[model samples]
Each structure stands twice: as structure tokens, then as C-alpha cells.
Target chain A: MARIVGSIMSTHVPSIAGAMSRHAEGEPYWKPFFDGYEPVRAWLDEVRPDVAVVVHNDHGLNFFLDKMPTFAVGCAPQYLHADEGWGIPEVEPFPGDPQLSWHLVESLIGEEFDLTTCQEMLVDHAVTNPMQLCWPDPDDRAAIRIVPVTVNTVMFPYPSARRCYALGEAIGRAITSYDAEEDLKVVLMGTGGLSHQLEGRRAGFINKEFDLRFLESLTEEPAWATQYSGEDLVRLTGSQGVELLMWLTARAALLGGARKVTSNYHIPISNTAAGTVVLEPAA
Target chain B: MGTGTTRHEIPGTTIFDGAEAQKGYALNKMCFSFNDGTNRAAFLDDEEAYCHRYGLSDDQTKAIRDRDVLRLLELGGHPYYLAKFAGIFRLDVQDLGALQTGLSKEEFQARLVAAGR
Candidate 1:
């Protein structure tokens, strides 16, 4: 049986990738950011998760205005970089684990998750940016396979935070039921969030205090976190509140109580809080 | 290869037809906010400025000068501006990528087809 080794919730700001990709070990802009994740890196090295299930929202990529599913899963062998208006940056293609992904998909659907599966898809910064932060490597692309899950946050009438948390629980059930012989240590990652508005006149708003409180509530009282519907979240934190659905992943991982390994918060990464948290299952 | 005489042929009809254009426009309008007065004004002003600056063909200039919503939508991909147009046209939210609640694609498609596409 497969078991979730840990979970992570990180902000998906594109600039974080830009910072890490360009700076050295102790450079001014990059030092604090990389240093913050040292403990997380050590934890991951110890746990050695076999697979990572990343929950992220596509930013006008793949599912454009044509059709955006509430939740889509990638079962492809590889994922290309999604072009966001301006073409894709010079980045390595993401390798996917088709077998594991399909198994999880079949299991989830059997468990009644209603997931949409894709063979070929493009992933934008929402998925890759935080990934670079968590698993920073140039050549070790195939070290761990990924199951990419997308949420609908671009348009209105998005899923409620509670619904997202429920989805997480379903994922937990599916992972445990998979018929695999190998010892599978799964990592559920929720990427995007920590209050920052983007769009219209309120493009540059940043609430560090709100971000910290939200992070605290995520680990301590996840149920309280889900009370805010998508609409309420938007009203309180502008349109970007849609990213709160990423917390569902954390909620899912915390089904049996997660031991907090590391947490860090930084400000003003192109008008957003660059925050990250790593949690492992309690011993 | 040596140069050879070649006949240039243009098809009488194309995929970019009236219905497709209309569908594209509807999709864009449904998805964006182009119906707002400010956005409409900016669009009109921009069209005029583009026509004047580029010295484009009469047909091209007319496409912009006339404010043909369908033509404009066909030219530019569906964006936020289309939502405003959707509001103005009163497009059905279902037609604008709202997947049916608690239903699979096959189930939703069957219902849609039964209701007449």
C-alpha cells in the first residue's frame, strides 16, 4: 500500500524561479530564499518520496477561455512549458509518470472524483515555479515522477475552499488504495496562495500579516480555513483569492496530522508574498 | 530544382466563415468584459488610431472602423474583453465553458445534443 510521506504548500510566484535560476548560493536576493528551504531539502532527502502530486492552477495556459475544467489531471509521459502570452522561456520539459498517474486517476475516478485526464498538456509557472524551488536541479529531471492536477481559478464561479479540501481527502483515499508492490512514498503539494491581488486597479496589493495568519490556520485549523467561499475570498483578498484552493492539498495531507518541518515567508516578489511550508506525516 | 510555372489557386470558401466567426465572437464576448462603456470606448479609439497609423487596405480599415465585433474577435483570440460582450449579448453561461454540476462530459453532451445544438 502507498502512504503519503509528506505535503507542501508554497506560493507560485514566477519571480521566485527567476531569482533561484539566476543567483548563486549566498547572493543577496537568492541567499535568504534558498536558505529558508534548507530544512525542507534535508527532510525531502530523508523521506525520499517516490512520487509528487502537484496541485496547481493554469494561468491562461492549456485550458484557455475556450474551456477550463474545474479539475484536470495530466497522465502524459511529458509536459511542455505553456506559453503565457509571450512565448515559453528557456526551461527544461517536465517528465511525467504515466503509469503511476493513470493508476491514481483510475483509482480516484473509481472513488468518484470526476477527474479529467490529459495525455499531452502544457504547464505554466503555476506548476513549474514552485517546483523549481522545491526540487532545484538542472539534470535530475527524472528523479521523481509527477502527477499534475489543475484547478479552475482563472474564471468566476470557482470551486469553494471547502470543496478543494474535500478533493484532497479523496486523493488521500485513492493513494492508499493503489495496488503497487514497491514502497511508494507520495508527496502532495499545493502551490499558489498567501494573499496578494493581481488584476485591475488592485494589482499590487500585499498583506503579509494576512498571509502569516492564513498559513497558521492552514496547519492548526484547516476547517476554519475552508469557511471562506471563493466569492468571499475574492472580496477579502481581491481576485487572487482563487489561489486559496491550493490549500486543499495541505488539507488532504493533514488528514492524519502532519508534522511541520519548515516554514518561511518573504514579501514583494513582484507584488506577492513568496511563502513556503513543508509538512511530513507524524511519526 | 528548376523554376516551373505554377498556377496560384484560391479556394472559393474558407473555414473562417460567418457562423464560425459568430461563434468565436460569442465565445469571446461571453468570456470577457468588452461591453463596458470604458472598454468599448477604448476599443473604438484604438481601432481608429490603428487604421490611421497603418494606412491599411479599405477592407481592413472598414473591419476596424465599423467596429465589427465578430471580425474583431476572430482577429484577436478570446480575452477578458469578450466577457463584456457576453454581458451585452446575454450569452448563456453554460455555452461559456460552465461544465454541468455533478455530471460527466458524455452525460452533459447527450443532454446538450438532445436539446438541439
Candidate 2:
């Protein structure tokens, strides 16, 4: 059986990669955002999980409008990175855990969640940025394997909060039930959100009040957000702010009450109200 | 299950719904192609011919030519895909936000910083 380490929810803003490429974390403009990750990095060092199950949304790197899957799970042996239109430099490919991936795919489908399985998936910044944020050193990043579970946030008719939460629950069950002979420690990650829209006249929209409350709800009332529809979330948060759905799904995967170990909320990280939270399930 | 009948309007924002997706297929498909460097270079070489090859609507072609962020959005462009189009000119989200809001880049950035306070 696999042991759950905890869950980490982060905002996967692409500009972070640009700043990182320039080695600008110490610069005044980026210091505050960069400092927030120190505690998380320390925690990761302590837990030292062997595998990370990343729950994120793709921003037009892998799947285009031609055929969008509502929920897709990567079962590949390795995942590569590509140019995401912007000039952000691509990172090294991340190793994957195919054995665990197949078990998850089997368990999730048995639990009645039909998911599109990908043998080869190209992850965009949404997946890479968080990895870099956690493991800034290239060697540290390469040590752990990854399993990407992407939900559709690129298009409308996204999976409802309830559905995303349920998916998280199934993920928790599947991870715990894996019949591994060796002991395994797995970390779950939810990437993106904290409210900021980047389209239409409301291009610079940010709802701090809503973002703060939503962050609080993650620990106190994990299912609090499930009450709202996708439209409601977009209205309250912002078009892109709705990426908070990824956070909810990751938080729900904890499967029980959890205490917020640490959280950082900052504004204007490249058109986003950037936020990150680490939750440890109640004992 | 069919919640499309009831539309929720968020002022100053456009939801990329099924209808919007249908309308922007050609334009978005063209934008998606920009993921490849060659396609981006080709689009820059001859903008009009590129638009024709993508089967873009006259309005969409004009929107591309004018680099009108708001108009392209009105024509059903997804911000994510339009972002690829914006990259041809090296414009990031802040630039797009400034363009759509009719504000200078500095003003838009300040507004975002102020949101935290």
C-alpha cells in the first residue's frame, strides 16, 4: 500500500518561469513570490516523497480545440515539455510512474469516472512551473516521478466543482489501495488559481475578498466551493481565476479534514492573484 | 445536465462556451498552429495569406491584422489561443490586459498590484 504524504496547491503562472530563467527570484519584484516557496521546499525536503500526482490544467500545449477530454490521465513512462507559444524555455522531461498510472486508471474507471488515458503527453507550464517552484535545483526535480491528471479548464462546460471533488476522492482511494510491495510515499499537487481574468474588458479582474475566503475554505470547509457552479466561480473569481478548481480537486484528494501548514497569497504575478497552500490531513 | 439553456453573464467577460468554441474553431486552430515555430514565422511573413490559409472570417482576418484584442475576443477567440497569436509580437498577458482594458501597461500592472492591498 502507498502512503499519502500530503497535498500542495500552487498557482502555475507562466511568467514565473521567465523570471526563473533570468535567475530573478532575488530581484525586488519577484522576491516576495519566491520567498513563499521556502517553507514548502523545506516541507518537501522533510517528506521526500517518491512520486507526485500533479492535478493541473493544460493551456493549449498538449490538447487543442480539435478534441478536448473532460478529464485526462497520463500513463506515459515519461512526459516532455514543449514551447507554449511564449518564449519560456522548456525544462527537462520528467520521469513517470507507469505502474502506478495504470493502477489509478483502472481504479478510477472502476469507481465510475471514465477518464481519457494518454500514453504520451506533452505537459505545458502548468505542470512544469510548479515542479520548478518546488524543486528549484534541476537534480532535485529529476529525483521524483510524476503522474499528471489534467482536468479541462481551457474550455467552458468544465467539470463541476462537485465532479472535480469526487474525482479527487477517487484519486485518494486509488492511491491508498495500490498493492505495492515496497513502501511508497506520494504527494498530490493541485495547480492554478487565486482569481484573475485575462480576457474581454475584464482582463485585469481580481477578487481579493473572494480569493481569501476561498483559501480559508480549503481547510475549514473543503467542500464549500462545491456549492457554486462553474459560471458562479468565474463570476466571483475571474475567467482564469476559475483555475481554483484545480486547488479544490487537490484539496479534496486528502479525503478528510486537514490543517493548513502554510499558505502564501500575492497579487499581480503576471495577471494572476497567485496563491499556494499546503494541507496535511488530520491524523 | 443540459445547463447551456441558462446563460450566466459576467459583465466585461465572455465565457468560452460550446457556441463560442464552434464559432472560433478556424481562428483558434490557426492560433494553435503557432505552437510550432515555422507556423509562427510563416504567419509573420505574410499575414493576409496566413489568414486565408486558416479560412479565417473577414472579421477575424481584420482582427488579426489590426491586433484588436477585444475584437478578436468578440469573434470568439479563446484567450489561451489568442495568447499564442500575441506571442508572435512577444506580448504577454499583461500586454493583452492593457490592450483589452484600454490602459497603458503600467496602469494595468499597478491595478493588479493594488488588488492585494
Candidate 3:
């Protein structure tokens, strides 16, 4: 069976990519956010999972309001990042595991989660930013293919906290049952949130207190998150912060328990609070 | 938690639900097309013609012409997609927020900094 060795939760902000390309090593404004990802990069090297399942939301790049799916998984053999206007520096395509992708698609549907299967997609920075943060060096990209599981955070009815956690439970089951013969190490990722409203009068709002508590609960009392309502999330978190449902889904996949290996939180990475926490199954 | 058909009534924000989705389809589609650089340039070259090409309603066309962020939101223009439309006018999110909240650009930026506190 494929072993879900670990998981990562992060804020996939687009400006972080600009900071990276500009080599903001010594710049005070950018260094903290970049520094925050340092340990995350080290952890990726240490665990070196064979593949990563990226859970993220598309920001009007791949899916517009026309036909946004509540949940979609990239089934292509290779996924490329698209130019999301204003020329965010491009990167090489992320390798994908099509066979494993199809397996999960069939299995998840059987598990009663009908996910839209995408054969071709231009992944936006919502997924790529966190990917680059975890795996900074190109040399490290080898051996770690990606399977993108995108959620609809742009429009509602987003997958609820309960449904998200349940999706993770389903993912945990799917990974264990598939490819029992192969010795595969998998890393699951859920990216987005930690508060900060992007639109309306309350733009740039961040809840550090609520955000930190969420990190604590995500690692310790994940089941408690299921009770969060749309209003509760919107009231506490920003409108965009509701995207934390993505993390709950990933946390649910780990099932029983996990230990947070690293945690990083920084304020206002271009109008959003940025955070990352790496978890490994408890010993 | 169902399909985004649920109605939400936030004090100052439009939820971009099914009804707004229908209302803003043409305008949003036009904005979404700005992902392609060529479309962005074409829209810049002749915005009125471009709006008409997409069959946008008079309100949406007026909103685009006026660079009115709040009006666009009221007309069902999604903030994320409308951002592309705003980008054509070189207005960033902070600038747009400045317009909606009646703050100067500098004041809006200051408020953003204060929000992190």
C-alpha cells in the first residue's frame, strides 16, 4: 500500500513567488516570509516523499465562474504553471502520476466523492507557491511528482468543514488500499488561509489569534473543526480564509494522529496571512 | 455546504452566487478572457467595443467605463475576475479598496498595514 508519510499545510500567496524571483534574501519586507519556509524546505528533504497530493483553490485561472467544480483533481501526466497576468516568473512543469491519479479518481468516486477529473490544466500560483516554498531547489524536484486536488474556494457552496474532514478520511483510506505491492511514500498538502479578506470593505483583515489556534487544533483536535459554519468561518476568518477547509481535508487523510514538525506564520504576505505546518504520523 | 446555491447576505459584499453568476456571465467572461495577454491588449485598445463584443449589459458596460469597483460588485462582477478588468486601468486591489471605502490610496495602504496589527 502507498504510505502517506506526511502532510503540509500552507498559504499559497502569489506575491511570495515574486519575492523569491527578486532574490529578497536580505530585504526586510520579504525575508521573514522567505525565512519562514526554510525549515519547511529542510523537512521536505528529510522525508522526501515519492509523490505529493496538492490540495489548493484556483484563483480564476483554471476555472472561472462559468463552471467551477466544487472539487477537481488533475489527472494529467504533467502539469504546467500558467502566467497569471503581471508576469509571475514561470517554472518547469511539475511531474504527475497518472496511474495513481486514475486509481484515486475511481476509488474516491466509489467512496461516494465524485471529483471532477481534469486531463489538462494550467495550475495557478495557489498551488505552485506552496510547492516552490516546500521544494525550493530544482534538484529536489526530481522524484516528487504532484497530484493536484483543487477545491472551489472562489465561489460557494464550498466543501464544508465536516465534508472536508470526511474527504480526508476518504483519502486516507484510498492511499492505504492502493498499490499495496509498491513501496511508495506519499506527501499530502493543503494550501490556503490563516485569514485576510481580499475583497469588500474589510480587505486585508488577519486573525493571528484565530489562525494560531487553528494550527494548534489542526495538529491536535482536528475533529473539532467539523462544526464550523459558513458564517462562523467568514466572521472569524476573512472571506478567503474559509479556504482552510482544504487543510481539514488534508488533515482528515492522516486519520489517527500526526506530529507537527515545523510551523511558520507571518503577517500580510501581499494582503493575506501566510502560514505553513508540516505533520508526520505520530509514533 | 451544498453546491454554492445557498444565499449569503454579508453587510457590504455581494456573494457572487447563482443569480449573480447569471447576471454577470458576459462581463465576467470578458474579464476572465484577460488571462490571455492579447485579450487584455485588445480590451485596452477599445474597451466599449470589447464590452459589446462580449454582449455585456448597459450596467456592466457603464461600470467598466466608470472604473467603479462598487458598481461592478453590485452588477455581479466577481472581485477576482473583475481584478483583471481593474488591472487594465492600472488599479491594484488596495486602490480599488480605496475607492470603495472613500480613503485616499495612501490612507488605504495605511489601513492595510494597520489591519496586520
Best by lDDT: 2
Query: How close to the true structure is residue A206 of candidate 1, measured as C-alpha lDDT?
Result: 53
lDDT at B7, model 2:
84
CAPRI classification of candidate 3:
medium
Measured with C-alpha atoms, the lDDT of residue B62 in candidate 1 is 61
TM-score for model 1?
0.70
- lDDT tens digits by residue: candidate 1, A111-154: 67788899988887788876677678755545777889898876
Model 2, CA-based lDDT: 0.92
DockQ of candidate 3 compared with the true complex: 0.50
Give each candidate's fraction of reference contacts reproduced.
0.00, 0.85, 0.36
Winning candidate number (TM-score): 2
Q: Cα RMSDs of all predictions?
A: 16.3, 1.5, 2.4
lDDT of 3 by residue, A214-257 (tens): 88997779877688876678768888888898888888899888
Alpha-carbon deviation at B38 in model 3, angstroms: 0.9
Q: Which pairs in model 3 have colliding backbones?
A: A1-A180, A156-B4, A157-B4
Q: Write the per-residue lDDT of candidate 2 for residues B1-117, one digit (tens) a residue.
A: 233567867899988888888899999999999999999999999999999999999999999999998999989899999999999899989999998899999999999999889
**Candidate 3 chain B least-lDDT 10 residues:** B1-10
**Candidate 2 chain A lDDT trough over 10 residues, lowest sum:** A259-268
Q: Write the per-residue lDDT of candidate 3 for residues B2-117, one digit (tens) a residue.
A: 23455556655556567777788898899899888899899889989999999999998998999887888878788778877776666766677678878897887676667667
List per-model TM-scores for chain B. 0.26, 0.95, 0.87
